[model samples]
Target: MPEVKSQVDPSDASPFTRVRQLAQRAGLDGFLLALLGAILLAYLWPHFGSDDGPLPLNQIANYGVSIIFFFYGLRLSPEKLKAGLSNWRLHLVVQTTTFLVFPLLLIAARPFFDTGNQKLLWLGGFYLAALPSTVSSSVVMVSIAGGNLPAAIFNASISSLLGVFVTPIWMALYLPNGGHNSSLWGTIGNLALQVLLPVVVGVLLHRWLSAWAKRYDKQTRYLDQSIILLIVYTSFCESFYRGIFQGYQLTSILLLGVLLLALFFGVYAWILLVSKVLGFEKGDTITALFCGSKKSLVQGTVMSKVLFPDARLAGIVLLPLMMYHALQILIASIIAQAIGRRAAPEVPVPEPVAGT
Candidate 1:
């Protein structure tokens, strides 16, 4: 008999290890917990992250946003983006589902939330709907499900760029009387400076810097997470200091959570059916599902600061987005793993030997 190695059985693991394993299987990220922790910290000590606070957190977060997009652009290749565009049919479906289908679904839900706190929650949902697909999560989910990575990357990149303009336009159209109407052009200009400009500069330097950016991808991700936590903390700091989140009860918040999940599944079902109707290959279907259904919390967070004018309002806008971001990650991770397992090709069984 062969000697056994020193492997430990999972059942023999400690409680903490078992919990960690369960979390990993469920696709839970520590960042999500950190996000909630940031909010809690903000609630407890709002002044630390506020405008007059010693830290100047908002400004730091703003600068970090620029660096995030710049590094994003630096890591991508113009040639690859072009190459990924060859599938016009797939591209059209993905983009249409992203910009048109997602927002329209929310627009249809506006009537149900015309009064009170519901309206604010509904507005947040609409904003999320209008936002672009996420870059990393969409691509990661698609890749796990055996989708076309090139197309996922291209669609995600293009979607972020498009959202810089499109999200503002959607807000302008929907909020004409909400004080943000006339400022659409101004908002776009600010985004151009903070978002578009950095991306353009990064792309220009991609040939020289792409390798360095890729080499330090893990570090960059940590920096991105830190910046996001800072942004969330500062935003909620202003909200708590101003007493914005106190108006709604916990039940209302829970209701919004339920509604957001409905929104996700509604979109997912639509994409699942339509991709089949369009005769999408497995990869294309996977890409369409993931890329089409995602919302970009990164872009949403940065843009909320520019769009809301008030930090408290920005915090309100981010509420649904933060919840949706967590929910989508969990559900999508499960789906991706399931699809990966089921979609794998079966190994061929060998025929019986004639001699036997």
Candidate 2:
């Protein structure tokens, strides 16, 4: 007789598979986890990423930032960005919410947080508000939720481009609130080098590099994440080396987490109400909520090095954005999945009949 064998259920998977499944269910992005790992690495080994360290990570980060934006420009579709422009009302709502209401919410909450240590965290929140909407993630979420894909693409792309201007201006206005009049305009000239110039070059080269961008999209994405990790690591390394986090307590971080959650829900709820008031259809509403409510971590990390005069400031100043980025992705994912499921057309079950 052949040896009898027991079959394992698919549910009983390897530890790694189970963990991955759990992560999917919870809508966790690996990039967010990698960010935590980068911070941990920074804390554990600040010396390697120090300004005077052997690797010259600062120079590497500077160069890497340009490359990331270059790839961004290479992949951007000028036609697709223009396709959704007919819906001026939707565009108005999305852009207004992103550039206006988002910041106002932070300003409304300002009085509660402008004290000593809290002031820094509040400044971080304002920076997050000032940053523009994300691109890929916004489009991805809107697509999943059965939203207006064209408008999603348009608003998200425009937001990123606008951020190259709007964010710095907003920061310049708010930096004074923290009693540090860091000349964000002076930084804008630097931005034109690392941020704008590369974007312009990439756009000019788009006809040639577009195909390459499509073919190696995944590889380019990994490069983007790697550069981001490097930036985070290096910035935090400088901060830790200089003892910038010394004044911050565990409670302060916990409070920041609470505030970030509130901000996410706060903006989300506000947009949902506005979309309804504006009589937007389901698709446009979803686009408005996801696109308008998001803050770009890519822009945040890329701009941080230039925005803050002190390398040490980048680490703390980035806390609110990193937190909000992780939070929005998580919450938006869950909401999108639920909405997708609800909107899915139900297939009819077959009824047994005369055959019997």
Candidate 3:
């Protein structure tokens, strides 16, 4: 006789189990959930990192950012980056989108906002466009989506380096009289010492430490996210204390959110079209889509201190970027999971013998 078999009913599963299954399916994992919590905490306790606050959160965040990039550089394989560089077409597309397409889009939208406050807000949007793709999140999302990881790493790293010069030139076009005293060379020097030096050190040590770095990849990711949260908290704190957010009306804020969403999807769609036109493989396409769509909050926050000079307007300038950062993560997480699922190989089950 055939062996008896039992099947569990879906209805019999506990509510907690069902909810967990749904969340897993939807990619709403703990990290994404914690991001929402981080925003709430920032809103509730923005004063902690204010200009006259009890803590030195900004200084701590600056150090943390360097460490984050150091680990990032440690994980990157020099051989992989060199090999990936041969894919010049992919590199051209991703970089062009980051440095050219994004800024052009925002510039085209300038005529829509003519008033003083509107122009400031528009400048915030333009600033977001001028920035480079994020390092950690861009690579993370592309890997999660089964993209060309090496190319993703190469493009993201180069984008950050390029932004050191490119972003300032873009800002100078419109912010000529913003009263910032620092020269562009001074800004570059600051970035080279704080951001570039640590990266070079990590790269030099990568051969000896690569295995250990891979071993603790998950922990490093958590550390990266923690540092980002710290930065967000301090940035929002400065904004909250200065009433920077209050300068905008509710309708305008909502519209800005909508515009950011549109910008994300618009770039994503353009990348998809371009990748198809170039006849890219699935992995390369995924890398291009993710890297092209993201803007770097890390670069933005660091550059803001140097570029804005004025503490009050710096917070306001950061607002659009903050919103874009959160939205990109949320949207990209969902999309990456969907692509991962689609790319996943189907497991073949064994067939039963005739007389088992």
Q: Report the Cα RMSD per candidate.
A: 7.0, 7.4, 6.9
Tell me the whole-model lDDT of each prediction, alpha carbons only. Answer: 0.82, 0.81, 0.78
Ranking 1 against 2 by lDDT, winner: 1
Off by over 4 Å in 2: 1-10, 176-181, 345-356
Worst 10 residues of 2 by lDDT: 347-356
The alpha-carbon deviation from the true structure for residue 103 of candidate 3, after best TM-score superposition, in angstroms, is 1.1
In model 3, the worst 10-residue window by lDDT is: 347-356
Clashing pairs in 3: none
TM-score of each prediction: 0.92, 0.91, 0.81
- Give the candidate order by descending TM-score: 1, 2, 3
User: Candidate 2, TM-score vs. the true structure?
Assistant: 0.91
Better of 1 and 3 by TM-score: 1
Give the winner by TM-score: 1 or 2.
1
**Which ten-residue region of model 1 has the weakest summed lDDT?**
347-356
Candidate 3 stretches with Cα past 4 Å from truth are: 1-35, 136-147, 175-182, 301-309, 333-356
Residue lDDT tens for model 1, 118-224: 78788888889889989888887887778998999999888988998899888876653556434779778888888889999999999998888889988987887
Q: Rank the candidates by lDDT, best first.
A: 1, 2, 3
Q: Write the per-residue lDDT of candidate 3 for residues 68-147, one digit (tens) a residue.
A: 66886787678877877788999999999999999999999999999877887898999999999987778877877889
